[model samples]
Target: MLDDETPVLDNHLHLDPDNHRGIDAVRDFARLGGTHLLVVNKPSWHLGVEAETGEDFRAVFERTIEIVDEASSELDGRAWPVLGVHPGLITRLVDDRGFSPDEARDLMQAGIDVAAEYVESGEALALKSGRPHYEVDDDVWAASNAVMRRAFERGAELDCAVQLHAEASEDMTEVTDWAEEAGLPSDRVVKHYASGRLEGPIPSVMSEKDRLETAAERGEPFLMETDYIDDPDRPGAVLGPKTVPRRVRWLLENGRDEAVRIAHVETPERVYGIDTEATLERA
Candidate 1:
């Protein structure tokens, strides 16, 4: 069983109130001992925002903030907003909106700039950006990388973490270089949906039983996440919201307290610079 002293944080998650379980899913997490969530913005298209201008992304970012606020109140947990453009949206801009590769990249950078404004104003904690996860031509790939670099620059400026959504691989040295080039520390960049194969950037590993066990055994620092999509049609697609806390509970029950503390307590404090346990105590 999870003790109240321990804090369980989901490093990356999404909640769409109009179309999914939303706060109800958060309640499930809190019930299972989750105490903090880094709620990220979904792609603009998911929110029905056709971004002809970069400012159009405000709708998605604002909605994400609203959802986080609601989750904070509805559950016995804390929720922080992480706003940014999803790299896959580049394809949507090209195919659906007929944007050229360069134009799409520029618009995505502008979107990251707008998200940075939220972080500047303290409405959000971090910015998210990354290249396309799927295969693409050289030109598209280059443009995607440029957009990700822009996100890194903004994160560096704001002194906040940047959650990345990029290709899955062990060697993230290339992405780490981009972040360092932009003056953001490599450790401040979080690799979402990670499989523990990472260099430089911090890994927000999916909370699978074996994966968690391996991560604990290695004793390297990492954050845990469910990456819950919160889509009704694809219910529990990536992972369910209750996963992190339940997994943490199991780990705790199995004498993995030190790893749990590193993941839930130390890593988040170092990466995001927020003391969730302190927040919980104040509550």
Candidate 2:
């Protein structure tokens, strides 16, 4: 039997028809005391599919919503939905097959318009986006803010959260500034994959830790994710299942028990809009 205290939450998972393992994986997770899973529906550049126009993107977004609804209904509280336009795809949108920057911006705006609609519908739990190496163009940043502002407006109406994937400490700062400028609650902006952004040989001593601590101090919730699937070859890429427990142990050892608890404990509840008191009591 799995102990209720065993912490688990797949904060950033890509669930597509091509890669889905079906309900059995979810059942296994639940059987092991996995409290929640936030299924993020964002385009993957690695997969080579791009949603350039609003209508084209809405189709995929709607399909993703359907998937989450199905999974949430089937699992009975094991799964939830997160929606966003990934940053990497933003690059693809701008660097179109053979278009100018102006053309790319026009294309990206179309997708942003559709994302705004999803946020307005209360179907999305949070807004998520990630840059590969923390490098983002001003136009892309502006577009992201426009989308975020629309989401914020709708979030206020529906009482939802905005989850973001910041690739570096600087990226987090830029997003934070935009959210602040938009008057969005600091709490609404949650950071994902925080530990993986460190660049130096000694990541521990780098600014990533400081950035996480600073965010925590500022009342912004930061999420630690394994983003890993079942693959063993890609150990450091995503948070592999086999590596999660060890990572948690390391967090516990490094005086980051609270961070662990925040990532494993508070985030899922917030994202899923669940009452975690009962789960915490069980733990």
Candidate 3:
């Protein structure tokens, strides 16, 4: 949407393999002028795994890294990857597969430990984790919290950025507190699928135009995202990948170029420590 073809980056979206989008979602996003994207992988590894071992968990993680490699190669370095044990996955592992809370926690921690290695190795730029579901039993709620706590702990140990998926507009003080206790800072977190008005030091991957305008006035740092599920059942659920650039263009037309630049470029480069210049050079 830029008049000058300035590359746009999507900070969050699901580009899992075999998505209903026949071609790779990265390509789809890129086709819309999105030069770079962060694949927040939540399902491909767990669309339900039958194997039940710590080793198996590690293998699944290894496969996720492979998927990232394949996508990067296919897209010529525009696809950045993120890995984590989402709360929904934890729910299924315990509720459907009959895992004890402790068992589920152990498996998730194992996978997260492996993902942290990828983070350390620069294979993954960020970690994705949070209570993705709103309503649930007390046990599921507690387990989700425990698993997310472990995610924060790993992010802290590795000093990597973490993307949080939670109920939109919810107060994020709890999450910030969790990060603080995990030895991570609130500024290291990115609030995914956010409503944009939520108050916090944590940056949000936001979409609302009003909030974008407000953020522009307040000089808040944020990133834009579609959170496109990529599931045909929920076709274009939250939005399309083009949403980021479209919003950026609108912001620019409305005289908010500074805000657009901060959200689309500066924040992502700073938070994930990505070499955007190197990424463009790869092109």
Candidate 4:
């Protein structure tokens, strides 16, 4: 089992009090030896916020900060907010809200700007953005790419990391090129739900045995996450909150000590610029 002193951090997770386990799920993670989490904001519609403009995203970002505060105060888990426009929301804006593709693109960029403001204020540590994972028309795809590029720009300006939610792939040269052009290092861009063997962006590999081993074998910095959605209906659709700590314990039992420390401590510190040891002491 992972020792009590080890700092096990989940790179991506969500907590929703209204319809899911919320803080209790975080408590569960803590009970299993998880020390910290990057609590990304859920989509606006999920929180019942009908965002009509970039300023309207304030509600979503505020709620995310609120949730992070709640988790930090009420549980042993240490949490930070990663706020941004979810790429899939572009479709919601265009199809359901009667926005043109260009309009949706502009609004999403505005949302990224708002998220950057949070990062600048220190309420959030990182940004999140990516194109739709599913197939779409060429115009929608182009708009989504535009939004993601804006996110990179904001991340560059803020000098913070950007967590990406997009289709799974081993090659991300195109995305990496955009980050380079935006003046953000490609390593500062993380691919959520990623597996090992990716070519460009840092891989926040899912907390699975084989994937973790593959990422470790890559011989570079990487992080691990469960991507727990915290939805009661779907349950463990992506993975459960306890998965990270438990997987770390499994790795420890198998004598993968360096891998555990590199993933849970070193990579997070480098990517997010947080002191894992200090956070654990505070926790």
Q: By lDDT, who's the top model here?
A: 1
What is the C-alpha lDDT profile of model 3 across 57-154, one tens digit per residue? 55545655666666566443366778776666666777788988778777776767767777889878888877755677777778778878888888
Q: What is the TM-score of each candidate against the true structure?
A: 0.97, 0.68, 0.87, 0.96
Q: Which scores greater on TM-score, model 2 or model 4? A: 4
CA RMSD of each candidate after superposition: 1.3, 5.9, 2.7, 1.5
Q: Rank the candidates by TM-score, best first.
A: 1, 4, 3, 2
Error of 1 at 107 (Å): 0.5
Model 3, residue 106: what's the lDDT?
A: 76
Q: For residues 153-196, could you state the per-residue lDDT of candidate 1 as single tens digits?
A: 99999999999998887779888898998999998999999885
Pairs that clash in candidate 3: none
lDDT of each: 0.89, 0.52, 0.70, 0.88
Q: lDDT per residue, candidate 4, 1-283, as tens digits?
A: 3565788889999888678889898888887888888999998889888887899999999988998988877444478999998999989988888999999999889989999999999999999999999998999999999999999999999899999999989999889889989999988999999997788898999998899989877778889999998877788599898999899988888878888888888888888898777767523
> Which residue runs of candidate 4 sit more than 4 Å off their true CA positions?
74-77
Clashes of 2: 2
Model 2 stretches with alpha carbons more than 4 Å out: 5-7, 19-28, 44-49, 73-76, 130-158, 196-221, 229-237, 241-261, 267-273, 277-283
TM-score, cand. 3 vs. native: 0.87
Worst 10 residues of 4 by lDDT: 274-283
Model 2: weakest 10-residue lDDT segment is 198-207
